[model samples]
Target: MKHVKIAGGLGFIGFHLAQKLLDEGWLVTAVDSLENRSELKLALEMELGRNAHFTFLQTKIEQVDFGDADVVVYAADNENRAALEAVLRKCQPDCLFVFLSTTDVYEYSGEWRVQPVTEYGKAMLAQEENIRVTCAETGGAAVIIRLPTVYGLHQPYHLKLGRQFVSYEDETGKTESMHDLLYIDDVTSALAAAMAIDSGQHTIHLGSGTSNPFERTGKSNGLDYQKAHELLGFFPRTSLAEGIKKYQLAHEEWQRQKKLAAMYDETKSMAAKHPNTNQ
Candidate 1:
């Protein structure tokens, strides 16, 4: 039985990966500061029963123990510097560490942009280096999985650059920006493969393939998800269109639920106020 500790295991990508590992009979320890614990728990129950081969740590990554883990999958993104150090300190001396980094490390948000990951992949690069140094000193190995834009079910944001406030070179539909959209399943598969690799301190780029293009006007042009295929021996099976459709469906359901709740609340309040008049 392979012991794997996943940080941020309750997140959008993390939960799916946990499900995959559970299916494969891996002993999985999943940790997350679940922002939506109730919904996530319900989803997990639907996917992997109450007594599955998975353990949930409902706390921050810094608070957990990774000492017994054979492989540690570090997936959290925000405030990650300290979290990385904590994982290194607690991981077993020989445990293989897998760092799930963003393709934002290689992001090209125009030449004049000053964002940290965009202007320079410094912060992410620093994280990669820190892990490399830690592993080298401890005789442990580390692998970096650089993922591009990931989308799938339970997606929180709509595919609108307006939400991101990106100033595209040409706002018209004629100009299209390249976004290497990788489905969540593909990201998980790459993570799984990295866990099995013995190659020391290697960095691999992961996407659906080369680069899946997304038009500013919501049209998708599929790219060969072959880079992952050639390098990691895996390709994303989910199509970008299909993934977008799922996200839209989930979003619509969520909106409907909210509207229904509001309607129920309004009816209950009216009933409470006019009980005597009705009687």
Candidate 2:
């Protein structure tokens, strides 16, 4: 089985990708700092822990040994640039390094430029440059996937927004803002396809290939996904309605679980406070 090391495997995209790889019968080593938004970490651990092919390591990328990995997926944020570079140095000569980049590196017109608008974009651009240079010097195969706003089940912010919108409409009768969303499954599929290809160096942009005016106020327009389609055979398969329905179902289930856990904790606390009262 192919051994893959996922940096930030506890993150949103990272966790999903790791699960997909594990399900596909690949041996997956999940290296995470456990520092990212960790609300779903326990849930993810509970779910993925059942797989015999999965392993979780709570540590920084720089501290791990990448010599045994066939593929290294960098799913962590730009803050781990130093650690990322360290991993690159220690990675096996034949290992494929995949970087999860963002569309923030491009201009509003969806054109690649040297300069980025936001600070986050600037950092991501720098991270991408570092990966490109390191891979070039080491003769390592690399793939950079620039992703758009990804949405799906267990996505914290978007799910919160959906719940807020429903409550807002019920209370104040006003509609909340929508987002230009690409389902998480589509992004995972694209990443998997990118990993399967043996082509040397590639930078691919991933999106729904169409602008949604209702979402993000038209900021999702002009992204060119031709390279992704032609090279990786990736295309968004989920429609907005279908994606939203799936997300809603998953969100409801998650909420139910959350409430049940909270109630269980409350009951335990109460029982501890009145140990002898129960006859």
Candidate 3:
């Protein structure tokens, strides 16, 4: 079985990619510090723990034991940058290093505004260069996959509209430029395909090549997937409407769970404060 180690293995993209690889019969090891822990992260940890082929290493990326691995997927976008070169240096000579990058390299944010690339955009560009140069030196294959805002279950709230759509129940926001958000599964599917490539360095774009108009007006970036299609045979299968419906159902279920958790907490508090109630 091919061995793969995922940095930020418990993160949104990291967790999904790790889960998919594990299910495909790869031996997966997850490297995470859990420094930025969340309810979703905890839940993901539990689900991954159930898989005997999975190993969760609670440590920083630089400290991870790459261990004769066939692949190293850098899925943690907000990890320690100072250790990145060091971490890449430790990879097995033949390991294929896959870096899950963002369109931030070109666009400002998920807003699709490309006017002046933000500082974050600059950083992503630098990181991509680092991967390219470092991997070239080590003679290991590398793939940098640039993705737009990705949304599905357990999506983060800061970068994109998906989490806000779910948590705030606000999808009616207006903007001039259209934002093309890829579903989490679509992005993961593209990444999974990278493992099949025997060798070479590549940078792949995995979303509509244009800035969509506001509110998912069905205007695409012209539905261009030329490079990704050629390289990974990648095409997104989920429509925006379908993805939104999934988010809506997830939101309703989350609300129900929140209420149940609150009620349980209240009951415990009441019982604890009034010991006689227990009798």
lDDT for 27 (candidate 3):
95
Q: Candidate 1 lDDT, tens digit per residue, 88-141?
A: 889877788888765555544332121333422566768878988988888888
Which of the two, 1 or 3, has more lDDT?
A: 3
- For model 3, residues 1-279, the per-residue Cα lDDT tens digits are 999989889987899899899889999999888988777787688779999999999887777778568998887744347677767898877889888766655543333343325565566777888888888888889988877667777776533444223222343432111235677888899999988875778988677554442334343343257789999999888776677777668769867877887899899999888888444
TM-score of each: 0.71, 0.82, 0.78
Clashing pairs in 3: 178-212, 178-213, 210-221
Please give the range of 10 consecutive residues that has the lowest summed lDDT in model 3: 169-178
Model 3 global lDDT (CA atoms, 0 to 1): 0.74
Q: Pairing residues by index, what is the TM-score of model 3?
A: 0.78
Considering summed lDDT, which 10 consecutive residues are worst modelled in model 2? 167-176
TM-score, model 2 to reference: 0.82
**Candidate-wise lDDT, in order:** 0.67, 0.76, 0.74
Could you say which candidate leads in TM-score?
A: 2
Ranking by lDDT: 2, 3, 1
lDDT of 2: 0.76
Off by over 4 Å in 2: 36-39, 109-115, 159-180, 213-222, 257-279
Tens digits of lDDT, candidate 2, 169-246: 242421112223578899899999888866488888776766643344544453557899998898889876677788
Candidate 3 Cα RMSD after full superposition onto the native fold (Å):
5.7
